[model samples]
Every structure is written in C-alpha cells, then in structure tokens.
Target: MAPIERRSGRKRALVNGEDIEKKNTLKRSLRQRTDTVKKEKPSTDKVNNNNINIDKKKVLESSSKENVEPPSLASNLPKALSCLNRVQPGIQGFIPHGLHSNNILYRLQHNAMGITRERSLRQAVVQSYSDQLANYRILTTASPFDRRVTAMQWHPTLPTTVAVGSKGGDLILWDFTKTEGITFMQGIGAGGSVTHLQFDTTDPSFIYTSSIDGKVSRQDFHGNNKTVFLNTMDWSYWYCSLDVNYRSNVLVSGDNLGNTVLMTRQGEKVWSHRLHKSKVTHCEFNKQCEWLLVTASTDKMVKMWDIRMVSGRKSALYELPHDRPINSAYFSPDCSRLLTTDQNSEIRVYGGPLWDKMERTIPHPHRFFQHITPIKASWHPIHELIVIGRYPDPQFPGYHHGENRTIDVFDANTGDMVCQMLDGSAKGIISLCQFNRDGSYLAAGMGLNTLIWTDVAKLTTQGALSVNKTISGIGLNPNRGSNTSQRRRNRRNNNDDEVDKLKKKLKTKTKTKTQTKTKTQTKSKSSRR
Candidate 1:
C-alpha cells in the first residue's frame, strides 16, 4: 500500500510542476501582447495626426480661393500693377516708373472695354502721318565721320538736333534745322565706336551712349562733357547694348559675354546677371511697361523679363527661340507689340496681352555677314509701320528685283510693303535708319555718311533735292556706266514705253466698216488708209 501511495505522490508532484510552468508561460504571453499594443498606440495616433494636418491644409486652400474677389470687382481696379504682385514685396519701392503717368500702368486698365475710341484716334493719326511720309525727299547728305556709321538718334526735345556715332569712335551732333548754315560738331573717341545712343527723356540736353570699348557714357548733345556711367574693363567683354529709363533713374547694359548689369543714373551698380549664353546684341526696357525688359542674344534667343521678378538666377518670364542669331528686338511705340529681326530671313511681330504669341512673320532677307552693318527693322515713332534696309540680293524680291536698292517701309499690321524710299542719290545699302520723334523726318546711315530725308511740303524747307539728283557728287553708282544690270533695267523700261505707244496708235486707228466696199476700199486703201 505504501509503495503504491509513493508512486502516485511522485506522479502528482510531476503534474503540479508542469501546471506551474504552463501558468508562467501564459503570464509571459500576456505581457508580450500588452507591450505590443502599447508600442502600436503612438504610431496609430501619429497617422491620425497626419490625416488631420492634411485636412486643415485643404480647408485653408479652399477658404483662400473663396475669398478671392469677383471678376466684376477686379475689372474695376487697375490691371498693370497687378503684375507687381509676382515680384518680391520689397522691390516695388525702388522702381518708381510704375507710377509715372507716361507709363501704361498709370493709365486706365490695360485691355479694358470701350477702348476702341482711343485706337481709332491713333489709327487716324497714323494715316495722316503716313500720307505726309509719301512725299518725303532727301533734304541733304552730310559726311559726319570718315568711319562707318553705326548708330544714330535724334534729340528728344530739339527738333533738328541729331546724334550720330561711327565705328571709329566719332560722335557728331548735327543741327539740320538751318537751311543756310547747317552745323555739326564731332567728338573723337567718346567710346570705341558708339554702338547705341539714347537721348535722356527727362533731360533732352543729355544723351547716353554704349560703345564697343566696354563703356557707357553720358554726355551733352554737342558730344561734350562725357562722363563714364558704367565700364567693364575686361578685354573679352564690352558693352554691346544699353537702355535708359528716365522715370526710374536706371540704366541697363548688356555685355558681349552675356552679362547684363543694372546701374543707377549716377553709375552705381544695382545688380548683374548672366542673361545669355552668347553676346547680348540688344537690350530694351519697355517704355509703356517700364518694369518689363527685353534682350536678344546671338545664341538664337530673345527673352523677356519682368525686372522685378528676375532674382538670383531665376528664369525669364518668356523665352523666344530663333532659327538664327537675332539682330535686334524692340517694343512698338504703344508697347503692345514686339518686333524681332533674325538672320534666318524672318521678322516676327508679337502682340499682347500675351506677348509670347507671334502675331505676324514678315519674310525679308536681311543677311548677317562680316563687313556690313546689321539691318534691323525700326518702328515709326507715330505710325504702325516698320522700316528696314533691303539686303542687296538680286534673287530676293524687291523694287526692280533688288537692282534699284531702296529702304523699305512695311505696314506692321498687315505685313504689306507700304512704300519704298528709292533715291538715285542714295546708292549702296542703306543699312541703318530711324525716324525722328515727330515722324516728320528720317535719317539713314550709309557708308560713313548720314542722309536726311524730310517732307518738302510739310517742312517748307528750302533746297530740298529730288531723289534723282546727286548730292555733292556722292550719289554716283560704282557700276552705273557699263553694268549689265543697269542696262537691262533701262532696256526693259524702254520696251514697256514702246509697247504702250504702239497700243495707243492701234486703238486710235480702228478700221471702219466700208459702206462703199468694192473699188474704193481696194484702190484707196493703198494711199488714204
């Protein structure tokens, strides 16, 4: 009995130990499960918090959108200054041109309704001015310099004072208003061959000049009192172009290595940027929108920038690509259109409110080559017409198929040939030309000489020569006497005249139906007919 009891007690003790281990195992499993739950609680909370932040952001966006003004209210407010919103808040204080009355911003809203009346008035003025331009003839020709003429500008206020620059660093101020005593004074080496010139709008007595000598200069109309406004002394870099904004008291200049620098009128540098890859051939500030700037580069690009938004290597507002190097880009008189001349035989006009869109493309050959002045189409000061020199290519279509070289004036809107300024005296390529501020006169630079043309009827000036008359023995063509092209043109005109005369005679001598047909018609026809 005792042995049996001992075996059963041992079995009971082993079973009890097993039961104890199972209880421990169960407690450990429970603690592990609780620890996992605690660890996951913060993670789940974090996910919920992220969801809440997303909801808040969406709601804020919706609320902001809802708070926007209605279109009706927005239309009543000004539009031009709205572009200022895109600029940094701190920049508006420095650019005062935005508030000037002459700029477009100070006027009624751009693209506003009921503006057709203003447009109609402008069109009427253009028509009257264009009619006067048709009667224009060369007033005189003056040799301002012995070097090739590069740039020219008329005084902003002085009606007859004109500034001319040449490739050999000559600046000439000519007063053509005098009929008897035409006077011109020249300064040598103002800069190395002034490439661009602009008369100060605020002070017409002063003029700004950009030159190939890496300098920008401000001087008097007499080409005296020159003060260097900006200079890039590096040998590989020189100022190729510059523009001044009188209202803002700022000047922007671009160099050959694509560096564009902004400076105060007093010659303090504001900022500089590498705006192009190659040479910056042209740079202009929009007169109407003074904050806007345009630049053309030999890298086959024309870019527009809102100077306010061009901060720290930012991209341009719009980038226009060209098939070839661009000669120039200019804003129209109204600043509503942009014109660009490219070497690949294209002249493009871009219109607003979005200037990026090309409105018209005029196919004209103004070739780019060495040893010739670049032909850039210039805008008429008062009319919507453009003038450019016709490249001397016989294959290109022109007046007499380029045989009689003439400066062409094209209607900007329709891209139609408006008029050809053909003069027997002004031979050779008229590479550079610009209309006076009044649009009453024009000056063209042709091979070291400047030719002035004016309306004889309007100006009432004496000694206005006919287009066919040579001026001071300077109008003779080098190949005029025995040139095959000239002979061919003369022969063609003669043939046309002879043909017209024969046609007139035949028309007058029509045969009548012979009533007395038989003998009289046969016998008298030999003598009387």
Candidate 2:
C-alpha cells in the first residue's frame, strides 16, 4: 500500500511540471506576438509619412513651373508705355494729328517740330498733288494717249508749275492752280516707258526725262525745243534710268546693257564704263558732283560706282557688290550715304566718301515680304528718310489684291524704321516718287492718277527737335531752353566784336591825344625860351 501511494505522488509531480512548462511556452508566444506587432506599426507609419512628403514635392514643382512662363499681354502695357516715354519725352500730351484724305488730293503740311536746328525753317507740304479730271484739285492728270503717268516733278523755282511724264513719251506741264484742263507741253516720243523726270535745279525752265529706249532728253518748258542729251547708240544698250545734278551741266545715264554713261550738256559723252553684268538701273551724283552710279542686272547684283576722277575718261573710282538686283538708288542729302532698293523688296545702304572706298553696307530695317517688290526709292531732300514704292503683285488680283503702296521712314543714322504710310484704295503700281526741294512735299505718280501728299509738317516735326537737340546741343537741361546756348554763343561773338572795336578806338584816340599834347608842349617850350 505504501509503494502504491509513492507512485501516485511521483505521477502527480510529473504532471504538475508538464503544466508549468506549457504555461511558460504560452507567455513566450504572447511576448513574441506583441514585439512583431510593434515593428509592423512603425514601418506602416514611415510609408504613410513618405507618401505625404512626395505629394508636397509634386505641388512645389507645379508651382515653380507656373512662375517661369512669359508675361501676358496685360502685363506688357507698362513696358510699352515706358518705351514710348523714352522715345518721345518732350511736350507731354502733344497729340499727333491724323493723316486725312480730302478726295485724292492729300494736303500735308510740313510740321516744323522735327527738323535739325541748322536747316532753314520753312512751311511746305511734305506731300501735295493735282490731277487731270479735276476730280482731285491741285493734282496732275494723264494725257489722252498716256498709258500711265510714270513720273512727276515740280519746278525747283516755279512752285505753281509741275511736269508729268507718261509711258507714251509725252511730257505735260500743268499750272496746278488753273482750272483749265492743263497746260500740256508736247515733247518727243519717250521711245519706251519714261522712267524718270527732273527739273534742273540750276535752270528752272529746263526739264530732263529718261526713257527705256536709252535716251535722255532735255526740254525747255518756256520753248518748244526738245534736245536729246544722250542716246542708246552712244552706250551699249538703251538707257533705263538717268539723273542730272543740281548744276545741270552733267548727265548720268544707266543702260540696259550693264553700261553707265557720263555726258555733258552738249550731248558729248564725257566717259563710259561697264559697271555690272546686268542692266544698269539708276545713276546719281552726290551734292559735291562726285558720282555714285547703281546698276541692277539679271545677275542679282547691284554695283556701286564712283566716277569722280574719271569725269573725262571711262573709268570707275570704286564699286560695291550687293546680293540682289537693285531697282533704284538714292543718296542722302549730305551725300555721305546711299540707299538702293532691289526687285526682292530689299533696301541697302552704303557709306560714301565721294570717290573713296565704301564705309559699310546696311540692310533696310523694315520687314518686307517677298511678294511686295520695291520698284522705286527716293530720299527726302532735307531729312535722312527714304520713300519706297511697291510694284503690283502679280499673284493678287483686283484692288484688294494689289500691292499696297507704302512710304516708310527710317533713321538715316541707325537704319531703324520709325513710321509707315499706306495708300488703302489706290490700285496700279507706283512708277516714280519724288520729294520736293523743300522736303515738305512728296509727289507720286500712280497709273492714271497723280497723287500728291502735302502738309508733311508732322514728319518735319516728328524728329526735328530731338535731332536738333542732339546736333546743336539744345534743350539739354530741363531748366534751360534751346535759346540759351544760342544766346550764349551770340553774346560771346558780340563781346569779341566789341573788344575789337574798343581796341581800334583806343588806338585812334591815343594817336590824336599824343599829337595834340606834342603840339601844346612844343608851343609852350618855344614861349618859355
């Protein structure tokens, strides 16, 4: 019985030990599970925080991109106004007058505001005209047989008279103020189309005309005499263009056969030279009688020639090359520069020293498309501005389809475009355009109607004061007026003159006083003796 009780106690002890082991195992498993749960919670929180950070970075990147774009139209207003103020600061609130058309006769008064101070002050039309039908007063008209009026010119001295040249070779002179049909002057057949016409600056009655037949004729408006100054037979081909100097003694003609002829008043060829591979389009003489000839050819080259030394012989002093065929060329008023227009609607300028090497070549600043071909170019008489005439565009039809005749102003110094004027309704092509001697009037011949733009006063004033200030040192300070410097200069000159006169008077008075004193002393000495 004792052995049986001991075995039961051992069995109970073993069972209790197994139960304690099981409890320890359960506690260890619970701790392991708790530790695993803590580690998982930290990893989940880290992933969620990283996602929030990525979203914030994306938002910042989007905001930065938006800030980098260009400013909108509304934002540019201040900048544009600032630029305008910088360009024109004087006379605040001075509004510019609009160009108004009264019938086809547009009267433009040359405003005195823009001229350089040294030039003489004159009020003239930067543009004016009269035509035949009397539809437009103060304009010139075409003839019965005239296909188109190619060129027009007013007598340099006779302001009331004007001459019109047509494609039919007829030269008509009209007293613009008269109500009659016109005072027509019958001249010789122009041979081909008349390309250019000019009144002799030296002789008001003498007029010159250039034709495609290679003939340049001089006609006396006062008389019925028409003399051929130059003919194509003298040169290689027909004279396509020509110009006479202010002296009226020398004539320059450009021919279709790439030849330039320099002739005298007696129809004698002074010199002849081949300038380009293509037809010579235009020729002109500088103010000093130094010649600058421009020749445009099918070769797409415009050659500049200086013939100052070879007035008696056929030789060129200098030649310049261009990329396109030039249709017309004009020299600035000072003759320090030249401008050439091409068939490609491009205008180029070359600096000049009469017969020396060219200084530089500059392209026209205005953007002109290929469809708008420039046919004629003329320089303003007093200002460094140019007028370009665009020929009819073959692609476009009807009035709207035609090339709009444009007159653009450029800074002769910087070649920067300043302003542009256009003819909205006029059709046909502009064959010739000229600025009158005063630079206040511009005359243009279009098809059957001759259009004149008068009262160019705004142009005269637009840049005149600024140019004057720059050149003459006027209006430099806000407290000082333009007359201050001028008055100072005048005072200095007057003081110098006064000093000179005082010195002269002192010498004379001293001589007279010395003579009188000498006589009195001699008399006194004799009396004392």
Candidate 3:
C-alpha cells in the first residue's frame, strides 16, 4: 500500500511540472508580440513635425489613390494605325475608300475611325497638359539665416543662380547647378531688412541691394560689399523701395519721406521729386522707355515720371488714384497696361496715358486688411494672370484668426480665381511674392521660410495645343518645350568635336605634304648636281 501511494505522488508531481512549462511558454509569446507591436507603432513626435513639411500634399494624394495610373492611349493606337494605313504615302490627305479591296464596309469603318482617332489625339493632348500641370512641385528650399527672407531675385540670364535677402540683413547667394551641393555665399550685412535686390546685368557675381535703413549697397558673392547710398540725413527717413535700370546705369528709388529719387549707379542723385504726401511704397522702370519711372506711395496715388524732364518739371505724366495705400505697382509686359495691389485687398488694372481707364478690379483672397503687413500680388509674364498669397480661413478648425498662408492665382483678363496653392499643413504667413522672369517659378517670402512653387499658370502653350479638334489642322503648336525628337537632334548637333578634329587633322596633313614636296625638290636638285 505504501509503494502504490508513492507512485501516485510522483505522477502528480510530473503533471504539475508540465503545467508550469506551459505557463512559461505563453508568457514568452506574449512578450514577443508586445515588442513587435511596439516596434511597428509610429512615435508620437515624428508625426507632429512631418505635418509642416510640403510633402503633406503628396501624402494626401497617395492616401486617396494608391498608384492609380493615367488612362492608356495604347488601345486607340491600333485604330489610328489602321486609319493611317488606308492613306497612301506621299499624300497629306486621308483615303475615303480602301483601294483593291474597294469594300464599302472598309471605307465606312475608316471614315468613322478617322474622326474618332482625331478626337482621341486631341483628348490625349489635353490629358497630357493636365498631368504636366499637376506635377508642379517644390524643387528645393534654402533658409540659412534664422531671420525672415525679405526679398529674392533670380539671375536674369543664369538658370541656377538665385539671391535672397533676409530681414536680419544677411545676403545669401545660392547656385543650384553645382552637383556636389548648392553653393552658398554670404555677403556683408545690409543696414536693415533688404527691401529689394537685383542682379548686375554685366557681372554675374555682382548684385544690387536696398535696405530699410536708407542704404543702397552693392555686393559681390565673394563677401566684398560697399554701401552706394548712405542715409546721412535725419536717419529717421528710410528707403522704402529701389529699382535699377542697368541699361541706363541709373537707379530709381523711393523713400519714407515721400520722395521719388533717381541716382547714378555710383550713387549720385540725378533727380528727386517729393510728389506723394506719405511714404513712397514702390517704384518701377518702364521696360519700353529707359527714362520712364513709375512710383506708388502710401498716400493712395500712383504717378508715372519721365526722367528726361527737369527736376522741377518732372511732374507725373499719368496719375492713378486709389482708395487705399498702394503696396505694389507694376506695368504689364507690353507696358500698355498697369497693375497695383492696395491695402484694400484689391488688384486694380488701368490703361491709357493717365491710367484713368479702368480695365478690371480683382479682389484678393485675403481681403480683410486689418493686418498692418500689406500682401502683394504679381503679374504673369503674359499678363494673363495674377498670383497672390491668401490668408487662412477663420473657420478652419484650429486656424488662428489672423494670417492667411495660402496662395491664390487669378485670371487677369477674365477676373476669375483660377487656382490656389496651400502652405503645407502648417500655418505660415507669406508677406511678399515675386514671379521669375519666365513666370515658371514663384518665390514667396513666408517669414523665415521662402516657399518656391511651380506656377500652374505656366500651361500657356499646352492650353493652346489642346484648343483645336485636329492636331495638325490647327497649325498651332502649344507644347512648352521642343519635341522630344527635336531635342535629341539638338543633342546630336552639339557633338561637333569629331568634325573639328577631322578639320584640324586635314590642315596638319596639308602642311606636312607641302614641307615634304619642298624637301623632295631639293633632294632631286642635289642628286642631279
């Protein structure tokens, strides 16, 4: 009886040990699962910071459509080929009937096919433009200084060169053509926030800059700089704006003292006029006339001046009055029209000699002018559109009531809002905006951040290409760039080194032959003697 009882006890102990091992296995599995879940989870901090990045737009797009491809034109290709085959070579016109076969069904099939193929080609062209427009994205961003980028200018002739001036008086020169990295050169500091900046037409390295402290300066990318215009007067008066006409070697400037002044490139005051009752907000030179200058002031007036007249007789040739302070005044590409943005949140266009002819008045997106910082609008090179930054809506869930950080593009001729660009997911205020020479890119000064956007209005040629029903029949090509085959041909043409080498070899061979002939003649004379 004692032996049997011991055996039962040992069996019970073994069962309990097996149960303990099972419990330990379950715990280990639970721990491993918890670690895997933790590893996959997004850290809370990373999510918050990425919201401000411009890639938010791309993220929004990806979530809505997972790699959805554009409609393929391949299916229509065979039909188009069949229609083309019906037509004979050396002929521009299409065939109404299939020869040899002479089948009525074949002729009718191609007749319908011809119309359908042309329509598809036109639709494909239109679709291509829409896709091109959708691809406008931020190429790159540079903000070296902690201060706000106040003004920026692209080199008129150079594709990759750009200059930016910040509120902290720092000048940053950036060149994108370098493959190693973007080359950054910091020049001498300005007196105050750089209100305006431009490139030297003759010298790629030199640039002109104007500051709020009444100092106009010239700086080279090598850090060498000299103040061309100094404010020795009351010091209370600061330069409100400055513009240089490199063709005439003259500078047209405006100041807080309500003075419109013209000076030489060396900084000698040639002409000065105190026309506005308040600060002169902006000044522009007419592209058509080197002597013509346009000035807009906070006193609600825009005046055009021909610098050829005497200082006393330098009265404005045209007077444009506004209900609010004019922040910016620009002439159209043709110089036949004028545009201005006012504190009233309006973009006004005028024509005629006196600019009394009102063409259109388009309102900006950020209409309430309660803020002191005035918003600016720019003209597309073709004069077909104007783009300005829009203020945020007050009703946006977490939006602050004050500044609108988005951009609104408007049609100048039709006075309609065409498109808009937002400032990522974060709230940022763009104080000023400027279009590049070709109107391909737009640079907006958003506090310390300079937002560069691919302007959607650049579809000027594509929009033209899609207008007509037939591709070749319209006789107008609206492609923004050269045809792909033409571009390849150009690349081939650029490789002329082989031809140059062959020409050089021929010249050398001819010289050697002439020397050999002279030597051989001398040898023959020697042998005869």
Candidate 4:
C-alpha cells in the first residue's frame, strides 16, 4: 500500500508540470501577434496616403485638360507643367489647376517664341568681342624738326635715345630721358628725303640714312659732323635701301634702278652689281656680312643677291623669279631664309640648298597666300613667324567698298598659315611692321599713328595680335659694346689680309719675270757688241 501511494504522487506532479508549460506557450504566441499588428498598421496607412495623392494629381491634370475655355491656355498647360516639374524645389511654388492655365499662357508668351535658339546662340557668339579686343599704350612719341618723318632709329645701347630723319633731309637726335621732353642732341641736314635709316652695329652713335635725293649720308648722333657716304645720282634714280657691315666697315646701298653698290666706310668703292632690271626695293646684311638685296619694278620680278663675292665684282649669288612686282623683301632672323611680298598679295618663302646656290630656284609652298597686296613684312626675332601688311586693292577704291586692308602672320619654317587681322574700319594702309629687338613688342606704322603691341599676352590668348592700330614709326633698342666693335675690326682686317696676299703674290711673279728678261737682254747685247 506505501509503494502504490508514492507512484500516484509522481504521476500527479508530472501532469501539473505539463499544464504550466502549455499556458506559457499560449501567452508568448499572443504577445508576438500583437507586436506584428502594431508594425503593419503604419505600413498600411502610408500605402493609403500614396493612393489618395496619386488620385488627386490625376483629377487635377484631367480637370485642367477639359477646361478648354481658352484654347491657347489649355494647349500650353502640359508644356508649362512639364517644365515646372523639371524645375528644382528651391526655384518656384507648386501650381494647382485654377492658376495653372493662366501661368501656362504667360510662360508661352514669354518663351523665345518663333526664334531658333541655335541662331540666337550663334548671334551672341558673333557679337561677343569679349576675347578679341587688345590693350595698347604709347611709350614715347618724338617729333623731328620736319613734320614729314621719313625714318627713325633707336640707339643700340640706350633705349631712351632716338634718331629721326625727315623728308626735308634733316637728321635729328632726340633724348627721351629729358624733362624738357625730347631734347635735340644734334641736327644734320643732308639735303634729301631720308628714305631709309639704320645704326651701325659696332657704333651706335653713328647712323646711316639713304635718300631719294641720290645720297647716302652717315652722321654721328652726338656730333653734328656729317659725311656723304655715296652719291647715288650717277648710279641710279634714287637710293632705296642701305645696310652696313659694322664689323667690316663695308656699306651696301641699293638704288631704284636695281643697282647695288658696295663701299668701304672710308668712302672707297669696292664693287657694284646691277641686280634687277627694275627698282631695287630693300637690302639686308646677314651675320656673315653677306648681302641680301631685293629689287622690284613695274616689271614684276624679285631678285635675291648674295653679295659676299661682290668685292671681286661677281654676279648675284641667287635670283628669285616672281610673277608680280615685289613690294618688300626680308631675311629671317636666322639669316637662313628669305621672304618676299609681291603685288599679287602672295607671301613666298624660299629656303633649303637653294638658299646657298646662286642659280638654283626651288618651288615654294603653294598653299600659303595672303590674297591682298602686301606693302611691308617683318619676321619675329625669336620665332618662325612672319607678319605682312596689306594695302587697298587697286581694283577697289574706297574703304567701305574696297578690299579690306589686312595683316597675316605665318609660320615661316613650315609655311603654315597662323592668323589674319583685317582692318575694315581704318582709312589708310599699314606701311610697315617691325618686331622689337627682344621680340616682346610688335610695332606697325600706318598713316600718321604708330601702334605698339605687347606680344606675350596676345600670343598666350589669341595666338597673335590684331592689326587695327596705326603706326607712323618703329624702333628697336639693342645693346652694343666694345667687343662687338673689335669683332667687326677683326673681320675687316682678315678681308684686307686676303686682298693684300693676292697683290703680294702678283708683285713677286712680276719681279721674277722682269729679272729673267733683263738677263736675256744683257746676254744678247754682249753677243752683238
């Protein structure tokens, strides 16, 4: 009976434990269901709000479309709404249907209606001169004794000193550093229109000027003493260009009749060569003192001469043929190239082995054309750039009706077209273009005004400077020293030595033959006696 009682008590305890576990499981599942319902309630509310807003938008859009009292207003609403939707939130207010039609009509009327946006954009670009204009400043302007200024030169060593020549044959020196403004250093009246002027590389104080009055005059800038270097009256119609070999004291002058005369600084004539059948336009000297002279005539031909052998009276080393009259010729800064501007407005470059051969003619690059009659051309001192100035076409007369006076710059080495500047507003033509000695500034001479341009900033932005301003005079300041003079004297002495040796050899041979003849004559006289 005691064992039966213990087994019944254990069964009763096990049954009570199973009943508590079932009640705890039911409470936990009920709490989980309540928490899930709390989370799903907010999600269901958000979905209902979204459906209501979508329905409202559709109703407003449909209402606006159906209320077509004003046809134009209704037609423009969709476009305006589309544009408004694309606008960012910070821009304007969100619009409803009542004001939407009016707003659409306002926008449609104000919109660039009937205008091609592309055409308007192109017009804006064309009218924008924001990047094209240039800033120019005048440094100094020194008027000479005569109002007709023909030529001017800056001192090689002093930037503030300048020599000016007048059409009245007056050479005036002006000191720019003076407070009295331009103080006259000296005046030399050489009795001719000073057509051309240059300073001696060896002596900056000594200046040379040539005139159409048939005279080449040399003057000391500090002293009033003047010397007539050569009289061109007997040689030709007028003296057009003058270049001096400061190291060799050899002066070369070109005349209107295409005659080139080589003379010593002491006024001894060395040799003369007739290069062109027409007028000789300009002349230049290379570092080797080899002469490069160009002649142009109404006859339409430009000739280049290598006058290094002219001391021996030889013909020109080279002659370049042209179909039109050459107005100007320039030797590049390297002295290895030549540029000739002609009446046909073509800028031709001649280079290669033909530069050395006197008779060899090489075909120039054909694609390079200026297309306007060029009056003057200059080369950039440090770059392979050539700048040319154009004149009014003879076929056209006035400024408004005539061909535009233009300036063109080209890559001299590769013959690539770089930039063009057209002056349709100006009245006169550009007469000359000159690059400063450092090549930092480019000066152009027009009718009565001189234009000076800073080259660095323009080249950085627009690749080149525009040719609109007028320039009447241009000057380059280069430093000269005793070393330069000594070098020139040494070169001159070497040339003198070569000539002396030839003369000495001839004298020796003549004496030897004379002695031989004397011996034979004495022997024959003794036999006769």
- Tell me, what's the RMSD of every candidate? 25.1, 27.1, 30.9, 29.8
What TM-score does candidate 4 reach?
A: 0.51
Cα error of candidate 3 at position 228, Å: 1.4
lDDT of 3 by residue, 170-225 (tens): 77665532323334454344446777788888886787777776776777866666
The C-alpha local distance difference test score for the whole of candidate 3 amounts to 0.62
Off by over 4 Å in 2: 1-145, 186-191, 232-237, 245-248, 289-299, 302-315, 354-374, 391-404, 423-425, 456-529
Tens-place lDDT per residue, model 2, 171-251, is 667554444525555445445667778887766677887876667888775556879877656433567777775464677
Clashing pairs in 1: none
Tens digits of per-residue lDDT, candidate 4, 1-529, equal: 1222225644642245444554555445434533554465543332232222112344345444544122243334434333432545686867654322323343334344642344333323222311121232223333333324555565666644556665566565555334343434433444466778888767676788898778888777555687997775653378978877766668888787767788898899888877667666676766543454444443465555565555322365666667777666667777777777665546777764466433222222212134211356677676667766555454433335545555556655445445555433333355566656765454554433334444334534642223331112222111112234545766899999999999999999999999999999999999999
Comparing 2 and 3 by lDDT, which wins?
3
The lowest-lDDT stretch of 10 consecutive residues in candidate 3 is: 467-476
Candidate 2 accuracy as TM-score? 0.51
Task: Tell me how candidate 4 scores on lDDT.
Answer: 0.54
| lDDT order of candidates, top first | 1, 3, 2, 4
Off by over 4 Å in 1: 1-132, 179-191, 221-224, 312-314, 394-402, 456-529
Tell how far residue 114 is off in model 2, in angstroms. Answer: 19
- Cα lDDT, all candidates: 0.71, 0.55, 0.62, 0.54
Question: In terms of TM-score, which candidate is strongest?
Answer: 1
